[model samples]
Target: MITSLDHLVLTVADIDATIAFYTQALGMTHAPFTVADGSTRHALRFGESKINLHVSGAEFEPKAQNPTAGSADLCFLTDRPLADWQRHLAAHGTRIEEGPVPRSGATGPLISLYVRDPDGNLIEISAPLQP
Candidate 1:
């Protein structure tokens, strides 16, 4: 059984653009590392989680059967309120596809905002509802 998520790989069209979006818009940190083959690869770090970047058609060995962009729907928890997220996204020129709508989260009810990344991945940023 999995204890907790360590990292996930994202098949992206442009690594630099993806990095810029996550770092600037989402406040994640960029971490570039050298692999076993001595090739440099990039990742976006937030909290204890990281998303590894792999260019489409040049993915590492043992990748997903159909590694495609724009196919993933990911949700992330935040301490900030939904209103603050709206302004932040606007300031960064990132569009919100939908919501401050209510949805069920892993723990309980949440208020979430949906946005798209450079690769068109659906990213839901949620804040847990207070009692």
Candidate 2:
């Protein structure tokens, strides 16, 4: 049985670009750290979770069979409304790939805004619709 997720590995083309996009658009913080092999790696921290940035082919070891960019589609819950996220994304020069449309999330009714990260990963920002 699996518990809650700790982190997700993101295979990216450029680490700096990924950092810039996530931090500037999503308000995540850059958390760079050294691995056991003395190699430096970067992560984007939000709330209690983080995404470990793994440069394609330069990943630590025992990685995916084929690591590629723009492969992740992750949804993050937000307290703010869809309009607020639209403005926020616009301020950061992020294009909304899709909607402020209605959808069903794990908790129930949701309003989501889609944006692409530097690697073209689909990042969905959602807010649970109040009952």
Best by TM-score: 1
Number of clashing residue pairs in every model? 0, 0
Residue 98, candidate 2: C-alpha displacement in angstroms: 1.1
Q: Give the clashing pairs for model 1.
A: none
Candidate 2 RMSD computed on C-alpha atoms after optimal superposition onto the true structure: 1.0
Score candidate 2 by lDDT.
Answer: 0.90
Which tens-of-lDDT digit does each residue in 1-131 have in candidate 1?
97899999999998899999999999999999998999998999999999998899899888999999778899999999899999999999999999989999988999999999998999999999999
Task: Write down the TM-score for model 2.
Answer: 0.95
lDDT of 2 by residue, 1-131 (tens): 98778999999999989999899899999999998989788999998899998997688677888889999999999988889889989988899989998989986999999999988899999999999
TM-score of each: 0.97, 0.95
Worst 10 residues of 1 by lDDT: 65-74
Residue 58 CA displacement from its true place in model 1, Å: 0.6
Question: Relative to the true structure, how large is the alpha-carbon lDDT of every model?
Answer: 0.94, 0.90
- Sequence-dependent TM-score of model 1: 0.97
